[model samples]
Target: MVSVAEDVAIVAFEQTPSHAHFNDSEPAMIMPCVNSVIEQVGMDRHDIDFTIAGSCDYLSGMPFAFVMNIDAVGAWPPVYESHVEMDGAWALFEGFVRLQSGDIDTVLVSGSGKCSPGSYREGFSLQTDPYVHAPIGLDPRTQAGFQAQALIAAGKATERDFAEVVARSHANAKDNPYAQLSGDLSVDELLAEPYVQQPLRRLDCPPTSDGAAAMIIARADKARELCDNPVWIRAIDHRIDSHHPTLRDLTDSPSVRIAADRVGLHDGPVDIAELTVTYSPEEIILRDALGLNGETSVNPSGGPLTGSPFMAVGLTRVIELARAIRNGDGGRGVAHASSGPALQQNLLCVLEGDG
Candidate 1:
């Protein structure tokens, strides 16, 4: 495992519901979450030594848009803050690293975005290679279709398997109040639906959503004082693969494998795993990469397939798994986050609750 000078734990977390159209500014959506997490930890805003956020400027159709989001965290107090052009999960990664310095005691982390007003597919195409993928409009959905086809061609999975993932995700989402889509869906019923991208049906994709999530993390000693049931962060590691899809094995995620190894994911029995299965086929790839078995409850919060708030989706996975561990649903769990196209980048966070 990655050794640390001092242990860190997530003391509190909050998230807004995934909305099809929030009809408001990004700050408006994020403020509530920030307030709720601060309240949960019973701390004043100034008590947080650092604050960081993650978001995409391309999605908002404005440059330096993340600066305006500071309104949600408040700037009048001149807080030490930072921003990442990636997902909020990356912000959490930075926050975790900052606490390791021992100079800072606490960090407030958040991620928010509004995909409703923008062309979700077109906006994300910018994340692709400008010399090839972007010009051809090879968006995430198209790439996901390619992944699904690769899975079938390799005989690793079938359409039925993809449908089953969707069916299970929607079913599990029923218990998640923040999920945008949830219901009883049969695998056969899902397979019958027309394909949005060949081999991948409509149900196999995530709904475009706008939402926000925030959390408070502190050093081990401060965490105990902040909350009665602190979820400890065991280890965090991230890795990336090639940007070109052709250079990679679509059916597998080597980055996830490396991160899992670095985090010592299989060091002990894992009670749950919250993976960033934005596409149904990704669930299979992630499952195989993480080497998780039936004993582990996967995506109990429904995962991104039910409601993808882009920037916030990955961080929400951490919050969901932390919530489960805190509720005594599990003693230890893993939360996975992904960025770039078709899981080109992956982050893993191992969490455990005090016995």
Candidate 2:
């Protein structure tokens, strides 16, 4: 439970658009973000203590997707590095752990995914329990619909409540050039749209997106040297809920709530919160569980409802949260990332501008 702010800090942060399409190949787009980060932080590629990344090929329809991004780092002279088949938040978690060892002064963490090339529903269905759920052919959207109905039945939420969340997200995305979907909608209009699934609709879910992002982490003194304002990590933690839908409560995401508290996200009211809730209704469950009220600025950048690129979604939340703190956009904030059906796995990071 040792916080990195007592030792390390986030010096630089960068990200690409969370859009629905890109003509560029995976590596082609990824390197630009990496290079942009390298230039912004005023560090040579070799100066990076270690490099780590996250990616998955199933969505990209190409195996070895992560291997292609290795070139992005100019990782010659064999800079120490590793990768995860998991989301970039997990990779970011690994990078922070390495930084905590007190040997390396800095590290770089990045992730990318292009989910626009194929039938994403067919693609995402594959992440389900291979034996039971896959055979049933349940896609993420449909599963979310089932969960939404259950939430209504449990009286935790109503159809109109979910629409309000979507309306807010789209409106918030208006100022974010990176957001894929932006609009001003009222609760009635969002509710009137036909459901894409029983309870989830086209607007409630994220479009398939293509994107990448990178961040720089440095020890305390080095963090201050690299940037006038450094966002210090107070805590980073993650946890998992049971994977089987029947075994869990779809109305509440225990994993997200627990992870947030574990990271001291509620030490006081956070000034900002970057949440990766891809579907609209999932936002309600996450917000309630984390004890957030109207005061906490949630997803000011529009979040994943604006765009979702599979494995890259989680890391983008972390990067945006760091940037908000480092740029004087906010004073204290919590970065919330999620994965799997109904927020099955979650990561919470608390960051502050103060050293």
Candidate 3:
């Protein structure tokens, strides 16, 4: 086998199929998938180099819900591990960063969320500044509401244009069993749907979903040794914005622009882009920032709109894109993730095939 000086590659990944009633306890949702991911990747729990997870405790109406969920990992005897209450996509970044040391070989990275409990809008409000912003009951969706207005004002996009995103995501989600919303609805039909928060229609917002996804990453040589097909990560990085969306330019995503540029996304035409835009309006911002035209394939996996299970949604984007590369779908692909209100945070990971 080659040495660890080579790039890292994904060995395997798995995400729970989105469902309406995942009434099972949080650990129940995590256990089966954890067992499946390790098996699919042909690795035993003892073989894991490290572990990291992401989840929102508010989703289950408790503090440190991830504590009990650790049982799913069987991470007894003190495995090198960590957790993030943020999106799993961000957690994946943490794992990727930690593996920079060659000493760590294969990692067990997963994220989960159960959105069926609290009002997503109310739960999201907690992300706002507690002192000044949270008191007003301002929700993240409300920020998107205003962003919808800005796009219309700039003539950059319109309600009808955003509706196209919803329609396409839904149609694509139909092919994705892990997707939460998959049904037939024409663009024109979606345009007529009522708005959930003015300017942003019901279809524009991602459905509250519960899901978990796992990815196995190994140093390039270990990857080659494990799988016949390997997707090598050429570049990866992430950025975060101010907590104050009002203090920032809500219409533009500088974080995305810088992140994609860090990974050289604008340098070439991206064959496939798995963008974690949870809202239809944010999709426009991501595409514009990436300088991607309609020719480039975007979100063939249905995206966050189809099945955003909170924390894990972002990590799932990376797993989906890596799967494409390993399957020989293309020479290169970019997976994008975001967090905070109205796309305030962004991460870019570029993967290339051996070819």
Candidate 4:
């Protein structure tokens, strides 16, 4: 586990509703979320010691597109900031590490994306190996199909299991106002729908969404001063597996297990777990990797399956778990994030309430 030099806690977080087509600039999507998080703690833009963001320039169809998002956070005064080309969860990783230096007291982390104007599947396919997978037109959906087939072949899960996960996710999403998709769906109803990919129905895939999320984190003392009940970040760890799909088991996530061990996920009972279940089959793989039992509530906010806003989806998981903890729904919880196709890289965060 990474040793904590100065304990960090999330004081406040906010996210925009996942929209099918935002029809706005990325900054417009981010402004409200950024404003709300700072307002939640009664802090001004200048009060934050540092700021960072996560986004994909490729998704914007322009290089250095992330630079344009600084308008939301205010660059006129010239704030110290940085950007990561991954998910907002990775930006949180950097923010958490920066605080350990003991020089910065607070950080503003944000992520936003607009996938409506472009083909997300084609865009994401570029992440594959250029020399191998990319040339064959292998996309995430096809990759997920392979994973589902592998699960069935291995007897680890069945098509019905995948349907059940989708049903539960939509059911749980009914309570999430920010969710773009939610309803009391049934496995039978979902199964009757035609398969977009064999063994993986259309419902098994995450919807393309446009949204943003922002969070304010601070050191222990500052966290206490900022919020009445701060959710402490107990441990955080991440790992990556081979980029080649052929090298992976498909049915298992060794990276998740390694990160889980490093974060001490089993040190105590888990009350909730918010995972990056972008695909239905991934939920089964993640559960097996994390060694979670029925006692732990998984994806209570409906997860990415309901509303997956590329850059913001991962960090939203952390935000959801923190919200649950603050509401007294649970004392301890785990939040997960993923990047790359077929869960190539994974991040896990453990959180706890002050009690």
State each model's CA lDDT, in order: 0.93, 0.83, 0.81, 0.93
Q: Against the hidden reference, what TM-scores do the models get? A: 0.99, 0.96, 0.95, 0.98
Taking the tens digit of each residue's C-alpha lDDT, what string does model 3 give over 1-355? 1122437877778889876668888778878878877887677788898888888888778887988878888788778888888887777777777778767888787888888777888888888899998999888899888888888888889888898888888887777767888888888878777888888888899887887887777887788877777777777878877888767777788888878767776555578899987889888888888888877778888898888888888888988888777776667888987777888788888877777
For candidate 2, lDDT tens digit of each residue in 1-355? Answer: 4345446678777788886788878888788888988888899899889999988878667778788789887799899999987778888888888878888888888888888887767877888899998888778888788788989999989988888888889899898887888889988877889988878778888888999888888888888889887887778898999878889889998887778778877776598899988888888888888889889889988889988877788888878777767667888898887777778788888888873
- Candidate 3 has what TM-score? 0.95
Model 4 error, position 229 (Å) = 0.9
lDDT of 3 at 50: 85
lDDT of 3: 0.81
The residue pairs found clashing in candidate 3 are 88-311, 89-315
Supply the global lDDT for candidate 1: 0.93
Order by TM-score, highest first: 1, 4, 2, 3
In model 4, pairs of residues that clash are none
Model 3, 156: alpha-carbon shift in Å? 1.1
Off by over 4 Å in 4: none
TM-score of model 1 (CA atoms): 0.99
